[model samples]
Target: MSERLNGIEAFVAAVEAGNFALAAQRLGLTRSAVGKSVARLEARLGTRLFHRTTRSQSLTEDGQAYYERCRRALAELDAADAALEAGRLTPSGRLRITMPEVLGRVLVAPLLLELGAQYPELSFDAAFNDRRVDLVEEGLDLAIRSGPLDDSTALAARPMGHQWMGMFASPAYLAARGRPASLEALLAQASAHRFVGYVRDSGRPPWQFRDAKGQAVAFTPSSQFDFGCNSLEIAAMAAMQGAGIARLPVWLVREALDQGRLVRVFEEPQAFGYAVHAVWPHARAMPLKTRVLIDLLVERLVPALAVR
Candidate 1:
């Protein structure tokens, strides 16, 4: 029974870590030991688990089926462990999470650090990225996403807060170019003004706004002076430097607005914005650590983002 358990642990670790060496590192076991344990398990099961190459290992069909069952079984065991830990009221274990780079660095990281200081037993492995990731495939424990989430039974989501899109410019730029009184006026003189556009996989995105009737609209400005940036921080910086007007989330530029570095181009509030969510894989029992973090995020982040 002990040997069987060891083999199962090795196999699961290898899959999650993406290689034997890394799995060994994670498990604090020698690489050769991990490989041998998996080999023994395969020999007993009478089927090949991995299609191995010198550089990489991919799961075989049978391996994929086995892994799914094993993962669920392990989750059940983890739930049992978490239940016991809940009584102690202390969360221990590493949480693997992901979030957008700027949001993670500016907001989430500080919150997590505070949590860590409060709970000495807790640890974290975080990935700050902009691209969407599959939580299960990536073995992530949680994700903080901004914008709409696709419907999925495999995961659960909680709304953290929302961010409003606002058009902003530096005082110098606004003084020189003059502010457009309305969205229509801005569109009419789109060529006369420059824009700092946000770029993604689909290229630069159009600035989002809402019509008087509360209908969504997009404005794609055209100007040789306009430039594209992949980072929101950079776009905000460019706007501060008087390069061009930028469409940015209100929370991101709140400090600049307060410091008189950036001014709102339009006084009317725009209804166009996106909801933020705290997402995690669905489980029979939620880990105490995950629950604690989620609660903290709601307590701290919601209020911060809620303020206009």
Candidate 2:
């Protein structure tokens, strides 16, 4: 029975990838190995599955029918695996995840900690960075991402919540410089006031605002005191020191706003903020650990971000 299935994966991979070389790459095997495996499969069935040439290969009539049957067989096997996984009552495994640094530390970490405490069998390996990650390449189980997502068929995303950005300044700075009455006034006074800005490797991003019509507009303020740093925490710290007005995520400075260290300059948040998501590689049967974590985030993180 095992011998009957020996080259089935290689043959299907070649068909789907359009060439043995690409199939080899997908299967993590050498090109020669893939070719040999397909040859063995053909010998076992006493039929040619592909029309091979120096440059390319095409599926034979028999190969096309066999490929369809094999695909269904594989899917059934996957469903069987999923059935057993669903029956398990306890989640037990090491879940490796990556997320943006600031949100991961302040908003996501406590929920993960609570999960760990509830399930002794579950453990975590978490990495926090601001860069986008490839889950399959990095062997990560899941990721927490914010902002716009690129269209992808290779992964799945579940919305966690929205993170709103608000402009803020220290009370001392507000007292000394006076708060601008409107967005127009703020832009008019840009030259006179310092702005604590967040800088990315690509360059500084413009601060976002909503006009009266509720359309989004961007403003790039000039600041001699700009730290040119990527960390949002650093920008918030600078704003707390009376350095300049800063645009930051409301969740990040919740403590400072409550403590009176920072005062919100704008009465309202930006029109559209980053939409947070929990992303993971697509699978027929998701690992129990990954599914539970995603569910927890959906349950808890949304309300946490809603807190002003």
Candidate 1, 115-150: lDDT as tens digits: 999999999999998888999888899999998776
- Over 4 Å off in model 1, which ranges? 1-86, 223-225
**Which residue pairs of candidate 2 clash?**
none
- Local distance difference test, candidate 2: 0.82
Question: Candidate 1: minimum summed lDDT over ten consecutive residues — where?
Answer: 148-157
Error of 1 at 303 (Å): 1.3
Clashing pairs in 1: none
| TM-score, prediction 1 | 0.72
Count clashing residue pairs per candidate.
0, 0
Off by over 4 Å in 2: 1-78, 223-225
Candidate that scores best on lDDT: 1
Task: Give a tens-digit lDDT track for model 2, residues 1-308.
Answer: 53355478778889999998897667545577678878988998999999988988998999999999988887787789878987889888899999999899987889889999999999999998889988888899999999976554345577777788888999999999989876788888877778898888878878887787788888888743455478899999999999889989888999999999999886753355788888887554678999889888878888877754
